[model samples]
Target: MIRTLPLLLAVLASPALAQGLTDLDEVDRQVSAFVGQPTPPVDRRLRLARCTAPLALDWYGNGRQAVQVRCPVPAGWTLYVAMPAAAAAAAAPPLVQRGDSVTIQVGGDGWAVSQPGEALEAGAAGAWIKVRGLVPKAPVLRGRVLRPGLVGVDLP
Candidate 1:
């Protein structure tokens, strides 16, 4: 039975490492309050390795000090975060955390990129694009990935 321990460990880590963030109920509440919208359930996957670029959210001012951003795969499921190559140049890479931090929640308006574009890579699964911040606001305590994906923001 001792030998089985290793196998069990691998299986557990696989989901949390690859699958992406999951079931962030507390984080959802915080985000809804922050955005002043009814928080909807959201669970999506982004193959971070494929993400040539990354997610960047800069926080300016007081309240919840949004230091850096990360999207570490909490479960094993080929986890990744991405943005258009050009977007990467425009914004910093998204932060990935080793452990779970429900503080970060992404919303539809939280980001702004050149244009909502996507590529399948060589033979990837989901639609993909480079992005700026999830919610480029300082007091923005949380964020969430909106269903149907990206929306454009007028560049200043």
Candidate 2:
């Protein structure tokens, strides 16, 4: 028993054994409650870190058809869980149409730049679509539709 106590203590002290992954069941429950319906199970493949703080949930997209689950800093992780198909189908209609003139804006830190561009495909607000600058030989880029005549490009 004395020898076994040391082995037990070492096992308990191990970081891998001490910190557990966040529970997927809890996520499903919270999401289900928010949407007023049963949500499909969160993918186990996500393997999110355990959160010490209370999880925060909010609508992710402009259409409010997806939930953004966040584990506040310390864990500092976020996951986007899409609502059921019926909810998605009820989202707002397309705002930008193919070949429409648009302002493509890319911003970071303290600086932002915008240029005239043309939409390559139609998209609703918050949807990603292909766009190209009006300048000759301008490369096609993909950006999110922010509203009519505006798209925001994310920088890597």
Candidate 3:
């Protein structure tokens, strides 16, 4: 029994080490409150890597209908939680106008880049829009509108 003690500890710790797990019901409640909308039920059979800390949920690709739940610790994985497909297809109107100065942010791994850009057209939170950077000759980049002046980009 003594010889196997270390092995037992390792086994118990493996799930948390490999990835973090979150309470689906709790997550749904928090997400719903944040968006002011009901979230789709997560399949109970789906297993997620456990997180050591609380999960941070936010709009992932466009910040419109999809929400991303991320582990706060290093090497923790990010899960993309989507809103109902029906609601996504019927999204809302543009939240911003053309020529509007907006904030742009793209994140990957554990780092994010934040900059300012001008909107090339009107778009809603999930709608894609062309954003012109401040640097000279910088090509217009496409990003999703997050809010009034905020946009979120999916990083590779």
- By TM-score, highest first, what's the ranking? 2, 3, 1
Query: Relative to the unseen true structure, what is the C-alpha lDDT of residue 116 in candidate 2, on a scale of 0 to 100?
Result: 98
lDDT by residue (tens digit), candidate 2, 51-90: 8898898877785668899998763899999877566534
Is candidate 1 or 2 superior in lDDT?
Answer: 2
lDDT-wise, the better of 2 and 3 is: 2
Better of 1 and 2 by TM-score: 2
TM-score of model 1 vs. true structure: 0.20
TM-score per candidate:
0.20, 0.49, 0.45
lDDT for 61 in candidate 2 is 70
Candidate with the greatest lDDT versus the true structure? 2
Tens-digit lDDT string for candidate 3 (9-105): 8977765334555666777787777556777766666566666788787765553567777888998877666877545534455788999888888
Q: Model-by-model lDDT, in order?
A: 0.32, 0.84, 0.73
User: Model 1 misses residue 87 by how many Å?
Assistant: 28
> What are the runs in model 2 whose C-alpha is more than 4 Å off?
1-60, 67-90
